[model samples]
Target: MPAVNRRLVTDYDLQDAMERQIGIRVFEHDHIVHSGGAILRFDDRTVVIQAGVSDLSYFNRADCEFFELKKR
Candidate 1:
């Protein structure tokens, strides 16, 4: 992982990241809550993160404070 260049702050930003298949680490209150996951999908209220192949995690848009792109 490298320094994050973009902080996903809006629904559009999240959607774009998902569409691009960009990996992301999610943070809540400045602590990492989700890492090593691929952005599966996102909408106005929720974002889905997929870990490995079958594990899917659902997180509220409001609960996530930061979304940082992970370098491939």
Candidate 2:
């Protein structure tokens, strides 16, 4: 009789060390603007972020709605 070896595929938890890094910053205030179809009154024309979708039509720019950040 011979022994058999088996490998597991769906029982692994991958983690990265860089993903758990955080740093502190000194700032009095900050502001950000995006083109995600939002409105604001006290942001000095800074628009709010809504969502992110994938359709292969991204403008590939920093001021586009594709990379907008939203609050959870």
Candidate 3:
């Protein structure tokens, strides 16, 4: 995990990430909730992340503590 300068906090931020095809890692406190996933889609309250080739993970926007953009 490299250093990230920006954190995705708003829906617009997530939208930008999705459009840019950026990878995101979700965390709750110091624990990782999701890792090495790309933004597949997002709504007002939830975000869907592509976990693997065919796996998708859903997360609530308010439940996530942090969304870190991974530098590829």
Model 3 C-alpha lDDT per residue in residues 1-72, reported as the tens digit of each score: 566646798878888888887778887666788877789998878889996899999988777754656554
The count of residue-pair clashes in candidate 1 stands at: 0
Per-residue CA lDDT of model 2 for 1-72, tens digit only, reads: 553322111112101111221111111123322223211111222222223333112221233221212223
- Whole-model Cα lDDT per candidate? 0.77, 0.21, 0.78
State every prediction's TM-score relative to the real structure: 0.78, 0.14, 0.79
Candidate 1, lDDT over the whole model? 0.77
| Model 2 CA deviation exceeding 4 Å by range | 12-72
Model 3, backbone clash pairs (residues 3+ apart or across chains), number: 0
lDDT of 1 by residue, 9-68 (tens): 887788787877777887887788887677788778888888878899888888885466
Error in Å for residue 9 of model 1:
1.4
Error of 1 at 50 (Å): 0.7
Residue 39 in candidate 1, Cα distance off native in Å:
1.4
Clashing pairs in 2: none
Ranking by lDDT: 3, 1, 2
